[model samples]
Target chain A: MHYTVKTAGDQSIIIYFGEQISKQTSQTVQKLSNIIESSGIIGVEEVILGYTTILIHYAPTRISFHTLINTIKAIIMDVDLAKTDERNTIEIPVLYGEELGPDLANVARLNNLSEQEVIKLHTEPDYTVYFLGFSPGFPFLGGLDERIATPRLENPRKKVQAGSVGIANHQTGIYPVTSPGGWQIIGHTPIPLFNPSDDNPFLLSPGDIITFKPITKIEYDEIINSQI
Target chain B: MIHIFNVIKPGLLTTVQDLGRKGYQKYGLSVSGAVDYYAHRIANILVGNQDNAATLEVTMIGPTLKVLETRKIAITGADLTPYVNNSPVPLWRSFTVSEGDILSFQGYRSGCRAYIAVAGGLDVEETLGSKSTDLISEIGGHHGRRLIKGDTITANAVHTNKICLSRRLSTELIPTYTKHVRVRIILGPQDDAFTAKGIETFLSSEYTVTKDSNRMGCRLEGPTIEHKNGADILSEGMFMGAIQVPQNGQPILFLSGRPSVGGYTKIGGVITVDLPKVAQLKPNDRVSIEKVTLDEAHELLYKQENIFKLLQASIGEGGGL
Candidate 1:
């Protein structure tokens, strides 16, 4: 398959390799990301990577839209997406169930599995970080066991507390901040996934593989109060 | 010295805002800032402040502020019947307010959101290179929350006895609120999803901004746009003025604080210059949509840039309120 680029807004361009989400599509998207970042294209402020698309934001005053698109297209065509190098595996600790996880029972009941079985299934597989979006430091993690797949709450909670781990469809993520959310909360992570005070705020980045390690509430609090 | 005051009565949702927070969106962070970015930029320029300077973004209902100190200030965006010390303050005109003067804003007579820019700008902790408040993440601005009663905002260190530009812009240059509004738009990546008739209806139909509108998006109540194929597409990147049609068929125009992306089908996007028209649209305000080519959009932005150049040349560059 080939890639296509389209104008998003006055100052942004959306580049896509495929229409659907797949491993190959993600690879293509990552390849595009690598090319843009390493291409040293001036005026390109940031390139947002997604499931199958990459949003390139540029400073309109500094660079024209045509020049940016052409520069990026040239870089994309020259880069080989098959070269996946330096993928990091990260282990994230989660305090599942009890007061930390308000919807753990609900998710397990919907999947016809006990709470313990749900935990075992959730932590058993290593998930890939598709991309970061929705809120600051919120990761769209893939590779969840389909049996534990659950739909978001019909009526979204007015507020989903920060660090609340949740599952939706085949993807699972953690809420970095309190906002109105519909995701089914299954657990909570005590670690500060996003802190503005720190130089490198986000704990995970795209192309990084993540595995969940079950921890107790005491461990959660200890980690939260302490440094990462 | 610059002064920052508190909200004696926060009319609706008033918060600190700047240009935006970029680079952080990839980490799922929202680019939350002024709902009307054009207005935010113009206000910053009018006050001789940096484009990313933090200012007070007042929603539909304006707030009552207690002036903490004497400072130069300018109010732009919406006409909210603003008064300081029981006297009407000129809109788009830089002026000084003495300490202990009560700056109160009543109901908005015109637009949905208004911006108040101080001469030296508001002093706030910057996060990720911006002071923009992302309410969803609770990370920026004055503790990442709406301005409440008795909140003391610190101002930057710079004081001037007189503003750089003492002249006020002509009424012809300033936008006026009316019942009829026409916004220019560019057709979208998802225009194929809607039937031709659906597109026509969207263009011709008269839509009214709902009362439920906010900084996130302006919900338009109008003719239901039906799609030819009922397919659920994955969420994608969305920007300010992007008109998204959900399953319910109602059109929602994304604003400044909208999510970085969405999954809904977007039929078109409002032109960058015309977004101020969308910004000024209030509840019950009827708006008409007009389609324009990409070339036209570029020309419009260019024209706006020329106007800024002219304004700066005529108005002096010393300092602005």
Candidate 2:
């Protein structure tokens, strides 16, 4: 689960492992990232955690490349990444069907189930936040039942509005910001996952758990109007 | 006092930009900033400003700005036939712009973008340590979007050192956007995955920058470089200059605000030194690729650092405006 720091440039160092994305790899990345951030290394500006790698950006004028490599290596060697635990569960109220969940019928048909069954299955269990990426605050949540596994749309829509709930591959996530996405849109959340104007911009972070609670469209409207 | 410009005519894609908001890439936010950093830096330096100071990033067609106060200003990159109060203003040099002076620029005579920087720099709140606009995130810069007509921008009068117009740029540094460019590239970590012919095709191909090119990526049209292992490689971290070959085999030269990572397999990455050439490329502009060793890439980067060091030594400490 450990690797050497690869040289990205005069200002960046990337720690790489296997090139695949998985929960175990992501947890290791999240653990390492937390250690680096809390350790308070000088000249280190930011640590960008990915599926299987971490990009550490530093101010070259303050810390030389050699010093940075040594500092990262020293920190990595002593840190025991296995002991990290305790996941926090976060409840998300999702308004499914009709105007909000436009694809609810499509998803139910794809899974060969009734619309009510689809909602029951979706809201049944908690999902782990494997990683956080894709348009600020968008979390790649794992632990979706294989029965509901769906592929992305063949031709992605030009634009998917923010707060749209989606499922692609074995994962489900809400689009934090309005951008083009290929995931199968199942529902929408009234909660703002990312708000730059707010003190806390992102709603979800890595290692946090999430569970959907079906809500009425009237409730969705209420939450949206009052969020500002 | 730095003269504020009331934009009378807004161009296609005029926005406030700086070096960009770094360290936000982890959240999948693109490092949105000036599409042409070299020109932006030059304009800042000419105006006695910091490298990351906010300035107007003007696209092909430039805007007509009315000076609201007296200030020092300079424009670089594209030749737009700029004028101040109906009198022609020289490019790549600073000039004192008086209050009520009407400053304007026309369509591009050469290059695709231009940088207009003021003495003290644009006064804007820094989000995540930068004034650069991220239109997608809608976070930084002037309300995080393109500049519009009738919009007045505040300027910070922070210039301590002034640059004399007599300090003209030498021929070596004066950018010539007219010349056909050969962008140097470093081989990728997955370079061996591609066949030798595939690699050769990428390096030798003379590609034309498609009109659809933007700050995101420059879609090159010419040779379709087919990959040996196909485009099924895992989505990995991407840099500013990474040349990714899509399913169709056309190489997309990613630029400033490309996604942090995607599923495409990158064949090679353009050297940082040659990025200025890539930045200046306009639609239909031809560009050739040349492969270089990692050492060569490091050497070019070192050379740039040395030049900055030399400038700092000559200008003295804390010389920025």
Candidate 3:
């Protein structure tokens, strides 16, 4: 449960759990983040949780850096790491191959498997959401089956469409918005991953479990049209 | 009550901004806000609006707007040589704009950005509790994008008698933007990952802001900072003013519209009080970093806050005459 606190800027401090990424370390990071966030620490504006760290942004006018550090340290000493919180398991419907997944054939060839087999392996295991980053509501997912793991495209596409499910090396994720990326695309989802107009903007959050459910292109079109 | 203005011409990049959206970075949401926060606050204060009231943030160029109704307004930050009805108006002061008066800006003058605050804040719908525009996500401010020609933006009706007229900030309080700027910083969440010589190079070298620089970050080209091992690190939460160095060793100073986290190594972070100076810098402007202690940075912020409070009190006593 040992951790180091470092100053991020005049108003923020980063609490580092460990140097490497591991589930145990991530759990510890999340546990401490929950305590600090729910503790009602005065002047704490936001508590952002990373894979192996947590950044706390505070208002200096209400609490000084020295006081904030001491308060956080005291909270850390009293936190119970064994406690686990209940989380949701979200199912994301995706359409694999064809125009939606432009890189699926390439990924299958690189992994020495058929496109169908690649989709099977990708959807088999439930992946853990490491954190949300790179783009809005984009989840950095872990637990990609090593059998279908492949490298990213050498030259990234100039613009990747929103809802693209992509894989790069051992990691896999979804592009929540239209952005430039280098991941190997295997499928596309019709469900809006992010909508700022909605009450809850993000579809998934850190600590949630995700499983990809293969759907037909007709179903994807139906979902898209129904939303309109 | 409706208060609107017709956009004659949209300058380079004009968008509505406030203090910024908070409590959403955990979901990977960016805290997009005013680039020059000091100037934003001062402009709002001069017009007798709340400090966090949304104001139009004008970039290198300024927009041309025709007042649809008579309203009190104030212009602050980089002097873009604003003109109202073909007559020059002063900077950092509050004045009334009559209906049908056309307000426009000349070419580049001194600074890189300016702020225009109405007596009542702009009445844009808030997204995630903020009116500031997140350019990348296209989700806040007016239609979640920059203002364009022919767009009309509405402002809340002013119902109070506290509207200020011809209220100007003192000459000493005004900031002068120069080609060469020195900003203070507090070294590292990753300073230990750099070689001592690399830190020295960063503190001593005069870096030129590249043309590609934007509200997200200030890209610098100068001496490369030597790393002890490599530049890549596990992606982690980032803050405003973070100086991140990538594989090329060039530093990119993250600003108001930066992403929530990054993988590059951060050598240091600039003091919050000095961010306005960085915001005023234009492309090709030379910048050097000066190291300071964390306590000193905190003290400087406190001092600035105190000055603002005193100024507000004085204005109340003088009745903004």
Candidate 4:
């Protein structure tokens, strides 16, 4: 993958993979991120992975910008371009509609479909977790069905509950923490994407494949109770 | 051994902070630490603690504490009229407190936040290698929330009778807090997204800090900076001190609790040395932004860091008053 390096700040630099978002780009970005992370290169403070970029925050005291870029360039030369199906396919259980997911009704009304029809379409696709952002373990997933796409709320809510499954345009995501958000929520998931106490903390990662499985409210309660 | 302090009144907003939680931004974690890094560092230095020792970050108002044991403590950054048993104490110096001394703060004199560092650092359990509190995430530092009344703080009690007591920082090393501040910035990765007029307006105009400002970020009210095209850009990683101009044209300056990534076009980043000043800005405070080369930013940082080196030698030679 051809990339361009640009200065993000005085101590940080960004490496761009491509203009468009694709699984291939995420693969390349993740590949380089893993290599550099495990490489234990000096001066590297933090390596943040984006959909189509990698941002490296380094200490200028330990290594110069030119030296850091040169080191990345050499590592990129030996990167594997072949795409492998090593991504994890995790199925998430969700309870659709009702109070927790107030916007589900609006989504169906906007698409001129029944609530059951919307649920059917929502569960069909094996969505790709493009990246983790917005909050900890909050995955910005790709591959939402366009037929049920809904726009965001005009005025954002004061606090959207955690575990809220929302849709904005063609994208869908889960809220790991309760924050002021404008996304049109369609459902609630029993499984938390973020658990700060866990060893991994974040349940999803870039390139992981996830599919939403519809479940009853009782089932959701059971899962939640079991986890506790 | 550990020294304990009971919170009689938690004041406006107070939390434990250190340098910040690093290497966790990849999981979208916000680094919620001391906004005034320089002050936090100096407070720790004055009390002979490591740079990353967790300290209490007191906001506009300050907390009232009942000291439970004799320990060395230093207050730095904002002047919040701290008092011990109704008598005023000095800032930027370490002193011994009696077991029952009433440590309290009266009013804000200058700056926005103050750091109180005890000799042995706070003994809070680290969540993800940090004692800093992230209020939004509700993790780390006294249960990831601001200090409340009746809350008790436990600190490691190290004997520091020789090195730190009565050691006041030299006059030249302290920063002056003012209503208006000139902040230096380094233009960066997305500067071209803004128009020449937009860049010119941004540089020329004076902005007022809005009331919505916090540890997360401050929204600036100023001239609308026009973008060359649209205001939105492809989502990418963001950092502290990033001046991101949104669709409304007003710039939002992210601080210590900035999100890991953003989609807005950032015009520039506040220089590292100037970040301490940025953290001290109060609501409605006026700010003038100036540009400097990256080399100058790095040089200023080195110059600021050299103060610690000089202080270490000076303290080692003379010990203290």
DockQ score for model 2? 0.41
Global CA lDDT computed for model 3: 0.89
lDDT of 1 by residue, A62-144 (tens): 67778887787678767776677688898889999987798999999999999999999999998888888888878888788
* Lowest-sum lDDT 10-residue window in model 2 chain B: B312-321
| Model 4 per-residue lDDT at B277 | 92
Q: Please list, in the order the candidates appear, how each scores on TM-score for chain B only.
A: 0.93, 0.93, 0.97, 0.96
Clash counts for the predictions, in order? 4, 1, 0, 0
Compose the digit string of candidate 3's lDDT tens values, residues B233-300: 88899999999998788999998999998998999999999999999988999999999999999999
Q: Which candidate is the best by TM-score?
A: 3
Per-residue lDDT of B116 in model 1: 89
Q: Write the per-residue lDDT of candidate 1 for residues B1-321, one digit (tens) a residue.
A: 244786789778888999888777778788888877766766666666666688999987899998887777778888889999778888877677778899988556887778888867899989888898888777789898888887888889764644434545556667776767998888876788899999999999999889888778889998988888852556566676888888888898888788776778888888888888887787888988999987788777878877766765653444432
Per-candidate DockQ values are 0.60, 0.41, 0.79, 0.66
Error of 1 at B272 (Å): 0.3
Relative to the real complex, the DockQ score for model 3 comes to: 0.79
Question: Tens digits of per-residue lDDT for model 2 on A1-228?
Answer: 458556553345668767767778877888888788788888887777766777777766567677878887887788786787777889999988787667788788898999898888888878877666657777877778777778888899898989888888777889999989898888888888887766766678778889999998788888888966
| A1-228 per-residue lDDT for model 3 (tens digits) | 678989887888899988888877877877778788888989999888788989899989889888898999899888877888787899999999889899999999998999999999999998888788777898988788998888889999999999999999989999999999999988999999899999998998888899999999889999889999
How should the candidates be ordered by DockQ, best one leading? 3, 4, 1, 2
Per-residue lDDT of B115 in model 3? 96
How many residue pairs of model 2 clash at the backbone?
1
Docking class for candidate 4: medium
Clashing pairs in 3: none
